[model samples]
Target: MLVDIRVQEEGFSLDAELARLAGVGLDVGGIGLFMGLVRGDGGLAALVLEHYPGMTESMIARIVAQAGTRFGLLACTVIHRVGRLPVGAPIVLVLCAAAHRGAALEATEFVIDWLKTQAPFWKREEFPDGQGRWVAARESDEAAAARWGMDGPTES
Candidate 1:
């Protein structure tokens, strides 16, 4: 299986990412992808993300590995961008390839669900009035991740 994971400050091209998944060869029967965008909520102008470099990547890799094993994925890629990003900008992308559509789709969803809650990243919302505040974790997100039976970020 091919597992590609990246954490960067630059944006990515979906077409190129899809092509890379396709390049995993003829045995891959399906591909699932998810793209997350920064929302323009409550007059928010931008979002700033931060991470602990090597530690962040390691945790994400573990998440991907677990997803791959659970779903029997053929290939997977996760890209999460950090730094200041304007509203409507892409924040994260996840791609999973498997022998069947069900597995691919499930794996994609699983990876993202875990990523949302488990990834060691911090975010702040910046308003147009030149103010910013740290974003808080929502109960809804915790509930979504809870469906997988994980209690905390470390368990993933």
Candidate 2:
């Protein structure tokens, strides 16, 4: 499996990224992709994401490796953006290519779900009223991660 993990402040071009996957020379029958965007709800102005640079990448790398072991993945790419982002801006992207649709889809979901709950990124939402608050983890995210039935790297 070929795993590519990137944590950057610049926005990404989906087409460009997908093209790189196509060039991998693998017989990928299906490609699953998920793009997460900043929501405009709750009078939000923007979201600020901060992370411990080296640690964040390492954590995501482990998640990708786990997905590769669990699924028959031909290639996988994960891109997560940090810094301030406006509403409607893309924040994260996950792509998985596999021999069958099921593996690609499941691996894509697994990577994103794990990243949400396990990645060491802190988020702060800036409101239109000039107030900012740290974002909290939601039970839904934890539940989603738990459904995978695989213990995360830091889980005791």
Candidate 3:
């Protein structure tokens, strides 16, 4: 299956995915999910996320497809939100279903971990101190992508 991608201002719901993949092909013994939300820390608010629409989606799609090839996942989902979001709101969601709990969990982790470091989105954080800043691209995030065992996000 192709990787799912969504870049929107509204929150994403995970329940429907759970229902669809549960006990589906391969008798998915388990499913693991992780969702990230906006934090109260000024670190995220200081900057807005800007994207190159078609390019952004294509990049995420390639990464997700690569994850599916590497992991034995029955299904996987990735949804990310962009725009002026309030604190504590959902930012990203990842869900994975597989024949075993371990694979399901690992696949879930891989999706989010890679997204954090490799996705093309640029985030600018707004500080409470009134000084907004762009998040310096994290070596950690790049490192995270490296650990995924893929060369990295595919070039455009």
Candidate 4:
């Protein structure tokens, strides 16, 4: 299986990523994707994300590995951006390819759900007033992961 995981401050091209996944040549019948964007809700100015370099990548790789094993994925890619990002900017991308549509879709969903609840990424919401606050995990996000038999994030 091909697993590409990256944590960078630069933006990614969806076109390039899709093309790369398709070119893996594994008789893949479907590719599932999820792109998360920074929302501008409630007059939010921007979002700043931070992660613990090598540790963060390792955790994400483990999550991706679990998804591949569970769904028999042919290939998977995860790209997450850090640093301050303007509203409407892409934050994360999860792509999963499989021999069947169901496996590909399910693996994509599983990886994203785990990432939301388990990934060691911290986010701070900045406002136009020059104020920023650390964002906490939402109960809805915990519930979503729980649906997949995963536990909620523990307080650090």
- Could you say which candidate leads in TM-score? 2
How many steric clashes between backbone atoms does each model show? 0, 0, 6, 0
Residue 144 accuracy (lDDT) in model 2 = 94
Q: How accurate is candidate 3 locally (lDDT)?
A: 0.72
| lDDT by residue (tens digit), candidate 1, 1-156 | 898999999999999999999989899999999999999989999999999899888888988988888889999999999999999999999999998999999989888888888888999999999999999988887788789766644563
TM-score: model 1 vs. ground truth: 0.95
Q: How much lDDT does each candidate structure score?
A: 0.91, 0.91, 0.72, 0.91
By TM-score: ranked, best first: 2, 1, 4, 3
**Residues 26-128 of candidate 4: C-alpha lDDT, one tens digit per residue:** 5989999999999999899999999988878888888898888889999999999999999999999999999999999999999899898788899999999
Q: Quantify how close model 2 is to the true structure by its C-alpha RMSD in Å.
A: 1.3
Better of 1 and 4 by TM-score: 1
Q: How many residue pairs in model 2 have overlapping backbones?
A: 0
Task: After superposing candidate 1 on the true structure, give the runs of residues whose Cα lies further than 4 Å from its correct spot.
Answer: 150-156
Candidate 4 segments whose C-alpha is farther than 4 A from its true place:
150-156
Clashing pairs in 2: none
Position 49, candidate 1: lDDT: 98
Give the alpha carbon lDDT tens digit for every residue of 1-156 in model 3: 434578887776567766766736767788788988767763544346676788767777777777677677767777888876666777788877777888878878887877776677877777666667676887887787677666675754
| Preferred candidate (TM-score higher): 1 or 3 | 1
